[model samples]
Structures are given as structure tokens and as C-alpha cells.
Target: MRSIAFLSADFLANPWPEYARFRAERPVWWADEIRMFCVFRHKDIRTCLTSTDYTVEYPFRVSRQVFGETLLDLDGPRHQRLRRPLAGLLLGQRDNIGFRAAAEDRARTAVAALRPDTELDMVRGPARTVPLTATATFLGIPPERHDWLLHTVEYLVSHLDGSSGDFARASALRAELEEYLLRLISTGAPARSMLGEVHSWVRDGRITAAEAVGLATLTLAAGFETSTGLISNALHCLARHPGHAAGAASDTGRLRSFLKETLRWEPPQHDTVRFARRDTTLAGVPVPAGSALKLVLASGNRDAEVFDHAEEFRPDRSTHGSLTFGHGSHSCLGTHIALDVAEAFIGALLARFPGLRAVDDPMPPITGSTFRRPQALRMWLGPKGES
Candidate 1:
């Protein structure tokens, strides 16, 4: 009982050792307090993700009062219907070429803005810079409004940190997001952007106004942090491994490997929970219906049975594939966009600044928060052409 309480409170504080123990002792252990079964094994993680027996609860019911119903929480045809407009908006065939170019172009612009011989927080500068403009391009928000949009999202998302389960903060954010979406919709800008299309879809009776607001808010919430964390994690890796960074800088061919390894080393989305819709067996354990299951993706990625030297950050490791973007029907919709931004930013930074290293005070430490990310990354921007 005491151990379980400790796991609940400090799971984020020192998860690696706990994960290792769970992997060896009880790969599919149940936590009575949270009433959720956790998967720490490589195979169990893969199986839980790949199997259709489980269901995800985005704005999870307890959370729905705050987030409302979006595709993140839906299943079956309802989810399919809700995703159609977003599919065309976020992942359509026609949208892919343009969005990719637009994202990369925005990344190039951010890189150009970096000041030589000046140390800075990549999170505020390039990290926020890349996603802010890219999301604006996708949603048709003007670039000048980037700061406000980011600020709003930042405040709201900050609520989601280790303490977001609070009712007051969640309600406030949800109310503000609702009003913002309503105002944006009332402007009647049905052009080439997602907001416009969502408005048009709502007008056509494809989705309700509430649904549109929920989905839009979901997109806004998920857009920045994912990209930001990935870049931070990559920089954390590159700064520590100059050799790997240097090699990848010379040949962009190693970009994919670096990205894969960084994901394994420090995955952005650490865990995803699913509500057990019905009693089912997972990894040889019986899970009762309505029970919650938390899949520790970071732990799964580092499972010793799955990868050799699972704890070490090895760019050359071949089993670098991961469910960090999730798996099955609930897989992240922005995967390609995320990769493009991460690869472009990391690849460009390494190529441009060869002497980048973590600044001592705000150094990138593995945070204890469930979302495994560096809270801040301060890199020393050395004079060019010197080690």
C-alpha cells in the first residue's frame, strides 16, 4: 500500500527505476488507488496499443467537463465522422504537400532569426517559433497574432501540468477556449484554413457548434507542446552527444535515426490511458470492465526485453521504433507534421551551430512530470567554426 502511494505521488519524479522493477516483477501491474492497470513491458505495451479491445478517453470523462467531446475520446463511426473534416484539414492528400512546405518554410524562418554568439532558451525562441507560425498557417490565424495565441495556449496548457486535474482551472480554460472559438467562428472567414472549414462544416450541419468548439480547442491544445517537447528532447540529446550531432549534421541521412533514438531516449508523450470498455485479458492478466489502464510509453520504449542497452541513449540502436505517437485508431494525427518540424529544426540547428551545449543553470534535466520533457533548455551559442 505504501509503495503504491509512493508510485502515485512520485511516479513522475523517479519513474525509470520503478519502471525497471515493474518490467521485471509485474509487467502488467495494477494500481488500486488510481484503479488502473499499468503496462511496463515491451510486448505488453505493444499488444495493449495494437489490440482493439481497449478504448481511449480524451478529455477523459472526469476531464470532459474541461475538454468536452472531441475525436480524442470518441470511438467507431462517431469518431470517424468527427475526424473527416480534420482529416482533410490536418492529414488530407491535398493538404500534405502544402502543409509540409509551409511548416519547413516556417522552420527555416525561425533558424534565420537565431542570433549568433547569443545564448537563449530554445523553448521560447526556436521551439515556440516553429510551432506558432506553423499552427497559424494551418488555422489561418495571422502571424502577427502568434504571440497572443501562444500565450493563451501556454497559460491554458500550463494548467495541464502536474496539477491540471483541478476543477477551477479546467473550467476556466474550457470556458475561455469556448468563447474564443465562438468569436473566431463569428468572423465568417471560410477560406483555406481549418477554422474556416470547421465553421463551414458546422453551417452545413455536419457537426454541432459545441463539437466544433471542442475539436478546435483540442487541436490548439495538442499543436504546440508536442512539437516543442520533441525539439527540446532532440537538443538535449544532441548537446550531450556532439559526435552523433556532428555526424548527422554532415549527412542529413542520419536525421531519421537521430529522431528515432531521441524518441526512445526521451519520448514526448510519456503515457496514454485507456478505459476498459469491457472485461478483457491483456498480457495474460484479467482487466475488469471500466477499469483504466495507463501505458507507460517511455518505460515500454526502454524495456530490456525489447532493446539491447535499453537505458543507454544509443543513436545506432535499430529497435528505435516506438508508439510515442501512439498506435491503432488513436494514433496522433499530426505525426508527419511533428517529424517534419523536429527533423528540420534539429537538423538545421546541428548543421548551423556545431558547438551548441546545454547552459549550466537551466540545463535539460529529465523532468519528473508525466510528459517527459525538459522544462527549459539553455544552450550556449558558440562562435562559428570552433569546437
Candidate 2:
């Protein structure tokens, strides 16, 4: 058995093979580079997400270190207090005339902006733009400030890969965001959006103004990566399996299954970390309390023990327990909206454009260790059979 340098250039560039090897040989390996126990099996990864022995909140969680005491950095009651009401409001907007319509409108606008005659980078065009714009709409951000929101999220996410200048830029960005969001909060609630809800929280004294800013920032940054990844990833899946393209576009059921398979095969948020609440054992390896464990969700999604013939991309495969979205309490709050965005955008792309495909057969490779997505997907959008 070989030791896994989980963050090595080789692994980060392409990790599927290492994930398979690690799951088979050392399901509970300790990664010396990051100084944490890496859990590769499906069950163990699920435990890291859902079990009482492990918690997403602790002094050492990376998110906490990055964004400080934001809503994403909280645990249990405090987390729920801020999230539950907001989640309820968000859910209410899930219906057609509400949140779903907002998502659809944003997605359609993004799709309509694409010019098929010339090559277009889908990731830069629709993938990133739709989510950020949709999120701005949802948060009631003003039209003038939309560009700031997009650029800020770009840097906020870039910090995860330790990109140069991102940390300092993040600091400056956070201060600017504080001023902007606080002003938004002061202007009073707008309709029934996330920003409005946070404003009410500040007014009601349920949370401080600074806490409200943290919460807004978290929500903005959170939805950006997930939806962007899903859109681009779904496109890649359809392109790779051209046989399934027309059928999925015409049929809603096929499209849903297609998205499900894409989520499992190439999840955007590849891995996440959890800290032990108490002394716990994962895959028979002892893990002391407070020890950090890296849950390889991408690996778990492909665990053969969990999903039969998992290595292959079977669009029809049952993806019931897939960890494409993190499981349990920490599951994505914007999941419903994200799905709406993907279905609308992908649906529009297929139905209106007909045979949509990558300009190149392979497309750009999915990149990033944390938020895995094609940085660029230059596409040729035309009638069926053009590609």
C-alpha cells in the first residue's frame, strides 16, 4: 500500500485514480501533508457528515479560519437559529411564481445571452454569471452593486486554492462587503429575499448588524460555487455522452437522472473537513477528539461498496445516497434553488439550441481541489448534428 499525499500536484490535478486506490488499500489513511486523517470510504465519509462523533464546527475547521464567525462557521442552535427561518423563507420561494421563477428568469437570460455562431466559454458566460446574478436577485442586491458582488465572490472562492493575493484581497473585500450589506440592511427589507430576512433579524435584535453581514456574505459565497459547478458539470456530462443528449433535453425525467449522475460522477465540492467531537474510530482507525478528518466526498460518491459499478457514468444509476451535496445538517441550504437553476438553464440550452456541445470533444478538464469545475467550457451551440 502506498501513502497518499492528498494535496500533491498529481492528486489535485486528477484524483479519481488515487481515490480508488486509497479507498481500496487505506480507507482511513492519515495525510501527512495536511496533518489530518483522510476518510475515503462511503460509510466513513457519511459518518463524518452525519454522525454525532464528528462535527463541522470546531476551532480548527477551515471555513471558520477563512470567514471567521459567519453563519457557515456556526454549530447546532446558533447555526439553526440563523438558518431555519431563512431556510423556511427560501423554501416558500421554491414554487413557480416565487424563487423558482427568479431562478428560471436568471437562467433564461443567461442562456439567451449566448451567441451560437462563435465559440463561447460556458463557464465564464452562463455557469458563473447565472448563479451570481440569480443570487444577487435573491438577496435583493441593487443592480449597480451586482458587479461588486460577482467580483467579490470570485476572490472569496479563489482564496480556497490559496491563490496569490486572494487573502489580502479577501480582507479588503470583506470590509467593502460590510459597508455595502450594512447599507442594504439599513435601507429596510426588500420583498422576501435573503437580504430582507437578514435585515429583519438585525431590526428584531435576533442578531447583531455585523452578524447579519456575516450571514449575507456566507449565503452569497455558498450559492455561487454550487450552482456554477452543477451547470458546467451537467453540460460536460451531456457532451461526453452525446447519445443521451437529445433524449435528456426532451424528457424531464431523463434530464433529472442525467443531472443526478453528473452530481455523483463529478461533484463540484469534491471534499470537506470535519473535526471529531469525541474520541471516534473511522474505518477501524482511532481518531482522538478534535482531530481533523478530511471526508473525500468525491471518493465516497464513487465507492463501489455503496454504488454498484460506480466508476462508470450510468445516467440511469440510482444516486439516492450520493454526497454530491454534503449530507445532514450541513447540506446545502440553496439546494432547491440550485436545482431549479440547473434544470432551467440546461433545459433552455437543450430545448432552444437543440444539440449543444463543447467546441472540443474532451472539453476542459474539471479543476480545483475544493470547488471542482471547468474554468472554461468553450462551446459551439447550434442545431442538432452540427457538432
Candidate 3:
């Protein structure tokens, strides 16, 4: 870790230069400090993400240890069963209108918190809470646990770049979260909540108590954190390119393009960690069995072969098959959810404060390497003349 630039302040701030270097030189480089292989090129990253030769378990048991063997730690039929609930929700759940309306309404409510004629930080306001409450409601978690749940899961995922003490803290937080999920399962949640469906699965033996708990925790954490990142990134993008603001907030077609570009440009979910299931090779570099690897989706998203002017944010340039969320079996299930949440929140914000614009030109180059987002989305929320 000492020699690796990955944990350095500079790298966390701007890793693209180094990522580009890796893609050109050592496409499949190994980090001896952590004994993990990093796949940099978009092509190789695609294989690692889509191929069946990697597992999130084994060398990456931290996920299992913390989240208690959720779908992320499973494979094949087992993983499929646990994924059914989220996939169902993503597929509309036969109640698409109701679910989408609830999420949009929650988004509007979150944005409505900001005052009309003042400066504000979107990160602290709607960017965080919109997804937090929306995920909680969808999961059927009580409002009492929403705030606590957000911080707890934030710690859990943020520990990837922390010390052993940080890991210990994450473990402790995981215990508390696990306890909450289990208790809620034992008692009840709303019948329409995703948690309720998972709870029913536990009741009917479709999944075990432990699996159910893991499923719920993963749902809550992934749903909220991923959505928050996309929302913040979208807001940051909106601030940078004010010309697209009207379209992103008002027009669905333009809004989708803006988000697709945002996801490709500065995707919230950066990388996916995995372990080699068997001896293999990525970009001609040997990967022995049990080798820990990081499929850097952030780098893959910028591969010039796939995206023209990969470094720039061009809304007109389609980002159709980009590796924004992830690839393959364990890919994120919240794509539509994140986009919808961002659209709703951004739309509501502009509706409330019509002249909202960035106080700083670029909104502080999105901080954090693991879960990237603008530290503070400072904006003048008043009309142009008032501001």
C-alpha cells in the first residue's frame, strides 16, 4: 500500500492520468503491496466482469463477512434466486406505476426541503435524502431507521480505502444493520415494500433467514448509496454544463442522454472487486487461482476504443453499452432506479428554484476514489437577478 499510488491523496482526487497510463502499459498489472491484480483496459475489464472465471467470494470474503453472504457472494442458481426480488422490482413488479410514483414523489419531497432564495449544498440535501428515503420506503423500512441506516451503510462501503480500524468499525456497523434487518424480518414491514417481499420469501422458505437478511441489507445499501452517487454526479454535471440544464430537468429524452453521459463520464460506482476462480489470463497476464483482482470500471468507461473523446462529457455522444454500473452476473440492479431518482430530484430542484446554478464553475472535481461524488454541490438557488 505504501508504494501504490492508489491510496494517495492525488490519486483519489484524479486517477484518470494514472489509469490511462495503466491501460497503455501494464493492462494487467499486479499490486504486490495488496497482492491484488488490477485490470485496466476496457477489453480486459469486460472479460473479467462478464467471464465466469471470477467470484466475489473466496479472496474477497470481506463482502461475505460484512454483508453475510448476500447475493453478491453467491453464484448460479443460488444467486439467481436471491436476485429475483431486485430484478422483479427493476422489471416493474407488476406495479410499475405505483413504485415509480412513490420514488418520484419521494424525490420531489426531498428536493422540496431546500429554500427558494438561498445558497445550498445539494449533497447534504436532496442528493443524499432522496435516495435514502426512497430506498427505505421501497424496502419498507420504518422512517425511524432511515437516518441511522444511511450512515451505517455509508461506513460499510466507505471502509474499502480505510485502515484496519476502519474495517473494524465497518464490521460493528454491519452487526447493527444485520440486527435491524433480522428484527424487521421477524416482525414486519409494508406489504408493498421490497423488504416485505424478501421477508415473505423467508417465511415461505424461498430463501434462508441469513440470506434474507443479506438480501435486504444489500438492497438498502446498494440502492441508496448508488442512487446518491448518480444523483450527486448528475447535479455536478448539470452545474458544469448549464446549457443542458433545461433539457435535463424538463425533457425525458435529453435527461436520459445527460444521465447516460454522466454515468459514462463520472459514474458513481467506480470498480468491482473480484477473485480469480481458476488459473487464467487477462490481457496475456497470468492470473493464478485465488488471485484477487479489481475490475476498474472507471477506467473501462474511459477506454478510447469504446468512447470517443472518452475524457470529455458529451451528452450527444451515446453511452449505450458503457460499463457504468458494472457487467455480467453481479452487475448492479439499480440502473433505472438511479436514473429515475436523479431525474425526479433534479427536476424538482429546478422547478422550486428556477435559477439554480453552480457557485463554483465545476463543483469541485468529485471526491473519493471508491464512491465518487462532489463533496459539496454549492449552488445559488434563487432566480438569476435575485442571485
RMSD to truth, every model: 3.1, 2.5, 2.8
Residue 98 of model 2 has an lDDT of: 66
Which candidate comes out best when scored by TM-score?
2
Model 1, 272-304: lDDT tens digits are 777777789887899988878888888888887
Global lDDT of each candidate: 0.73, 0.80, 0.78
User: Which residue window of length 10 is worst by lDDT in model 2?
Assistant: 89-98
lDDT for predicted candidate 3 compared with the true structure = 0.78
List ranges where model 3 is wrong by over 4 Å.
1-4, 163-169, 384-387
Which residue pairs of candidate 3 clash? none
Q: Which ten-residue region of model 1 has the weakest summed lDDT? A: 1-10
Q: What shift in Å separates residue 287 of candidate 2 from its native position after superposition? A: 0.9
Estimated TM-score per prediction? Answer: 0.88, 0.93, 0.92
TM-score: the better of candidates 1 and 3 = 3
lDDT of 3 at 30: 91
Query: Among these predicted structures, which one has the highest lDDT?
Result: 2
State candidate 1's TM-score: 0.88
lDDT tens per residue, model 2, 1-387? 777665577767789998998888899988777788988899888878888888777774556555666765667888888777667756674332266777889887877777665677888887888888887888888767778789888877777654566566677877787788889887854846677777777889998888788777777887788888999988987888888877798798899888888889999888887888999788889999989888889999999888999999988889988987788888877777677788888988787688566888666788777888887888888753221
